[model samples]
Every structure is written in structure tokens, then in C-alpha cells.
Target: MSNTGAVMQKTLLGWIISGAIADKVVSTSCNLSIDQGLDLKLSKFWDIEEVTSSQNNYTAEEKACEKHFIENYRRNEDGRFIVKLPLKENRQLSLGNSRDLAVKRFYALERKLCQQPTLKTQYTEFINEYVELGHMQRIHETKLHNADTNKSFYFPHHAVIKERGNCANSPP
Candidate 1:
């Protein structure tokens, strides 16, 4: 069935109408249990499943993420959300070494910012405000390694100040 048996183009009365037979998304039926079995399967593209159950479909790790978010997230003094990143297990971070990539991207961003002084100012102010709001913290470059793993990791970040949905090249 997965490899694509005969595809059903449409249903005529109670019988399925057969069409092409290849690896594709199409409604099909077969009698697996019995020779006259009547079970129809309609592909929702990319073999994606529909959420039909009343209960949540969270995996253990996903449930753990939700639990972490629920337990740790809080409101700031101004009643704004001070949300923590939902991670799995005992607050463990498995970020790999990304200092090189981060530094490269940082230089690229710096170059772009230098070209636009007003944007640079706005971005700087935004980052400063983020730090002031306790949403972010300034860390020394010398102490950038994770204590447990002893690997340098960097969190990737970008800003999206939207007048409309464009990108970094445009003046957002």
C-alpha cells in the first residue's frame, strides 16, 4: 500500500474507481483481511495524519517540553510574558559547537548593520532593551563554553520587526 498499489480516483456509489498506480498521494482501498475487504485510505499528502482524537497527541519529549514551559514560565513586572525555552529532560541543553558559524553570521550581520546606521541603532536599542528586560544576558567571550560539555555553543538569533513580511535585506 505504501509503495502504491492501484489508486482510487473517486468513489462511485460504494465501489472505488481505480486510476494510476505509482508512488503518489491518492485515495485507495484494498481487502487485506479478506479478499472482499472494504477499507479506504485517503492520503493527506506527504502521508501526514489527521488529528482526530479528543486526547492530545504529544510524545513523551513533547509532553516534557510542555511541562517545563508550564512550570518555569512566568510574567514580568509589567505583566508581559517572560517565557523560558521549552526543553526536554532535566533542563539539559544538547547544543553543539557553533561558535565559528555564529561568529561568521555575526560579522555578516555587522556588515549589513554598518550599511544602515538607523537600522543598526534600532537593532542595538532592541537588543539593549531585551537585556534590560532580563530576557537576555551578556556573557563574556572567554566564558562561552558550556561547563559540562566544554564545547562552545552559540544561540542563533534574528529580529523580525514587521511592517510587512519581508527579510533582513529590506528595511523592516
Candidate 2:
């Protein structure tokens, strides 16, 4: 398995254990506060110090980047950076913008998860497991599809690429 898969598995296991402990603690300690219960449960199975240190390192790196960008980048009257580029560069810029939007959405979701630390364990477990399962399902489907000779998949868009006699690189 890749490093990401291993990390997800470990995180899922941790959350499962933590959830079980939390359930037991809540059942037995009727008067205990949610925070106290969570603390007790996490202390038993989770390495709080390690997680905190990792989070601190991430935060520090982010702050450093923000500081650097603020000091180095200049904005125009529209409160944005102005750059001059040739018409040929527009396509590349559009593609880059799409990638940036995806990254922004991912970070926004992470920020939401951080804001809800109490539910972080369960949420992380669910999201990671769900995503991994989906990936596995897609791989399985692709393998099955590849085994079938009746269907075909195309690349470079259907309108752009065409099968012309013995030549495979011809445009439609």
C-alpha cells in the first residue's frame, strides 16, 4: 500500500478504537462532561502530543507562507495582482485556475473539520474510509471493464481524436 493508504488505515483504526472507548465512557459516566469524556477516551488510544505537534508544524508552515506572500506580492487598485501575458498563455492560466479552485475547496473542508474538533475523529474516519472504498470500487470496475472486449474507452476527447485507417494520431 502507498503511504497515504497506510496513513488512512491507521487513522481509521484510531478513530474506531476511540469511538468504542467514547461509547463505553459515555455509558458509564452519566455525569461526565463531553469534553472530559472525550479526553479520557482519547488519552487511552490516541497520541495527543504527536498529533498536536504535527498540527503545530503545519500551522507554522502555513503562517510562514502567508507572511512571505504578503511581503513579496503587490496588489493593484482592484486589490489583486496584475500580470501581463500573451493570448497563448490564457489556456494554461485557465487550467491552473481550475486546479487552484480544487485545492481551495479541499482546504475549506479541512478548515471546517478543524472547527469541529469534537467530531474530528469520527468525521475523518468516515471520510477517509468512504474515499478509499470509492477508489477501490473504481479500480475493480476498471479491471472488469478492461476484461470486456465489447466496449472501448477514448482519450483526447471524442471530437478531437479519430481512428483513421492505420493512422492513430489523426484529428477528426
Candidate 3:
């Protein structure tokens, strides 16, 4: 497999594990069946730690999402956020599609985050960084295409640190 494929697989796995952890559905015996040949078990506490670490290995936009989640939300004892369902025309629906419910929950969280004054600057900075990273990635991909190279480029960790430094030096 190419490096890009490996990176994408790792990213998808990280999202799966993070979502499971957040939903408090992570179990002591975790089984993953990707294909007929790939059956894996994640056991013990260390396995959870490994998955958490992988989730932290993210792009600028992803890091922003993680920051937003951590700062604006609190998990219950079960490690899941208590999200109330939206009322539909003064009546509560007993059943709803999971995907639609998830989208509503996400939008609710985003609205809560937007209400915070202290987080406003942070969120703006996050958006700026995310846009910058997107532009940089597109440029890099174009360069690679012109050079006829199949290599994929990820943002350097040092660039993140450098951006932090610039933010610190600048006035808000």
C-alpha cells in the first residue's frame, strides 16, 4: 500500500476509536474486522492509550476540532455527553434516524461553542490555521502533480509550533 493509503487508514481507525470512546461504547474486548484476512483484537488498557495517541496525531483542522470538543464539552461518568433531542413542533419524537440525530447533536455542540466569548478568538485562530493548511496542502499536491510524483505530503510538526509562536507574538 502507498503511504497515503496507510495514513488514510490510520486516520479512519483513529476516528472510529475516538467516536467509540466518546460514546462510552469502548469495551474491554474490542474486535475489528476490516476484511476476511484482517481480524484484530484490542485488549487491555494500553490498547486504549494507543488509540487515543493515534487520534492526537492529526492535521491542523483536526486538532482544532479536538480542541473545540475538549474546551466546550464535558463528558459524563459514562464518557458520553448528554445531548437532548430537539423538539419537533411541540412534540417529542420517540424514534429518530441515528444519522440525523448525530448531525443535530453535532450542530448543537457547535452552537454551544460559538456562544463562548473566550473561545471566540481561539476558534477564529483555528479557522485561520485550518484554511492555511488547506491552501498549503493544495499547493503541495499541485507541485507533486507537476513533478509527476505520487508522494503525499503532511504538514510538519515544526510548522505548528512556529504558528503558535507567531500567534503568541502577535496582538489579539
Question: Which candidate has the top score in TM-score?
Answer: 1
RMSD of each: 15.0, 29.8, 30.4
Question: Taking the tens digit of each residue's C-alpha lDDT, what string does model 1 give over 28-106?
Answer: 5564331223333334332557546633778877777767878888999999877787644455556776777777888
Clashing pairs in 1: none
Q: Is candidate 1 or candidate 2 better by TM-score?
A: 1
Listed per model in order, the count of residue pairs whose N, CA or C atoms clash below 3 Å is 0, 0, 0
Better of 2 and 3 by lDDT: 3
Best by lDDT: 1
Candidate 3 ranges beyond 4 A from true positions: 1-102, 135-172
TM-score, each model? 0.41, 0.21, 0.20
lDDT minimum window of 10 residues, candidate 1: 32-41
- Winner on lDDT between 1 and 3 is 1
lDDT of 2 by residue, 126-170 (tens): 657868888423336557445433332221111112236655665
lDDT of 2 at 160: 18
In candidate 3, the residue pairs with backbone N, CA or C atoms under 3 Å apart (3 or more residues apart, or in different chains) clash, namely none
